[model samples]
Target: MPSTSTSLSPLSTGLARATAGLNLCHENASEVWHQRPPLDFLQIHPEHLIQEEGGTYRDQLDDLRHAYPIVLHGFGLSLGSCAPLDQDYLQLVKRVLKEHPEAFFSDHVSWSSLSHHHFHDLLPLVMNDETLDYLVERIDQAQELIGQPILLENISSYMRFRDSTYDEPSFINALTERTGAYVLMDVNNLWANAVNFGENPLTQLMEYRQSSVRGYHLAGCTRQQAGDGDVYIDYHGEAVHETVWDLYEKALRHFGPWPTLLEWENHVPPLERTLQEVSRITRYLNDLSVAPGAT
Candidate 1:
């Protein structure tokens, strides 16, 4: 059976500090550590781990699993779509999990493709009673197929439906309450949505069922202003903003310390820079734990 718990070994604090200045794209992933920097966790995109020309991918995963704790973050599970679940994709995911028994498996809460049309980005779902019922049943089926509990991540969306009745937090809370699945909260996405949609992100966080959150995501974003409109995009490049850090601090206070992942997908910086961001978040987490009256 696939393992549900993360490993107990402490990430290399010294390596995390030493590479706190390196560029991410320039460095080869294989040479990420001269000293094997302590990583909080290494997240692999599921597609990257299991391609048809799968020899190198399998070898790399084998090497990675031996060195650090790994988590499988999938991009293709369209959990909220009206369409049926992709059995082939689920089978591949199951195979990967079977191979890496120690890794935690997770995917997004939003839907992607529908009716043979594939959208590369995670799109928002209409929040309603019908959608809620569909999601709960889908979550139950997915958990049974995967043979382990899956973490569903809240995704960033560029649009919302006028007909939608439920807000994001209430929808998520209801899903967790009914399905018993854990949440993978993405702080940058929440902040981006707040800036774009004029909703207070902190208020949404407060309304969420905190006990359902299993992990958190921190990423960099880009801000754009055109005419009277301004938007913050979850670009996952550059350094994380002060606003994101503040939100993360608030999240730590609300949900307590959970596994946090710093994502830098586009404009991959040096490994050191990524490590620095992770280090910074870790410092804040440590500080939060030591603060007076902190639980």
Candidate 2:
């Protein structure tokens, strides 16, 4: 069976020990591990894992799996969509899991489709009772079909509807309560939303269902002042901001050392750059742990 637990899965209560990773981008595939840096895992978007020849990377992936832990962070699941679960995609994911039973899977919490039309973006869902019930039902169905629990990620959104009755944390916690699923918290996305919507991330997300959050994602954002006002887009193209890094430290102080992933997609720097951030976060996490004989 597919691995349902993460390296720092919520099964443990105390502070997470030491888990850090980077997104598996094709750009750095050739120059991976500049001098073989220390990393705990690799966050993979399986859709991109396929070879250019339109064939799966069974051998290539298996070879890499031996060296590092792999976790699937997908974008196409569209777990919150009203449309029926994508059976073909689910089967593809299942095959992947079946081969690498140790690898875990997760997807965004936002909807990307309606009535069979895919929007190709992770759009925000209406955060209310109707949408909550709708999503829980879909997640329940998805879990049963996949035969494994999945983590829901908080994605970046450009707009928020007036119909959003519950705040992001409350809605996420509610979904976990009903579905028995875990959350893949994204610190960059949280910081972006707070900037765009005028909320305090340190306090606004203070009451998250900490026990259900096993991992986190941190990336760079691109800011823009549009007709709609200021916005911080999760461009994932630049180095992580100092502001976001400060917020991340607060989160580490508050939530303890959750397994954090350094994400770089668009303007991916050299493999060495990602390793530096990974080393930076790993060191910070080591420091975040309660010191030897503290108050």
Best by TM-score: 2
lDDT of each: 0.72, 0.75
Give residue 216's error in model 2 in angstroms.
0.6
Candidate 2 regions off by >4 Å?
1-17, 33-36, 49-62, 115-117, 290-295
lDDT of 1 by residue, 1-295 (tens): 1222222222112212111122122133545544466775577766665452555445655566557656678877789887888887777777877766655578887888889686888989998888888888887777677666678888888889987889888888877677667787889988888778888889878888878877788888888885698888878767888988999899888887767788776877656667788898778777877888776
The digit string of per-residue lDDT tens for model 2 on 156-272 reads: 987889989998899998888777778888889998988888888777568687777767888999988888677899999988899888888877776667778999878788788
| Global fold similarity of model 1 (TM-score) | 0.85
Report RMSD for candidate 1: 6.0
Each model's Cα RMSD: 6.0, 4.7
Candidate 1 residue-wise lDDT at 211: 82
Model 1 lDDT vs. the true structure? 0.72
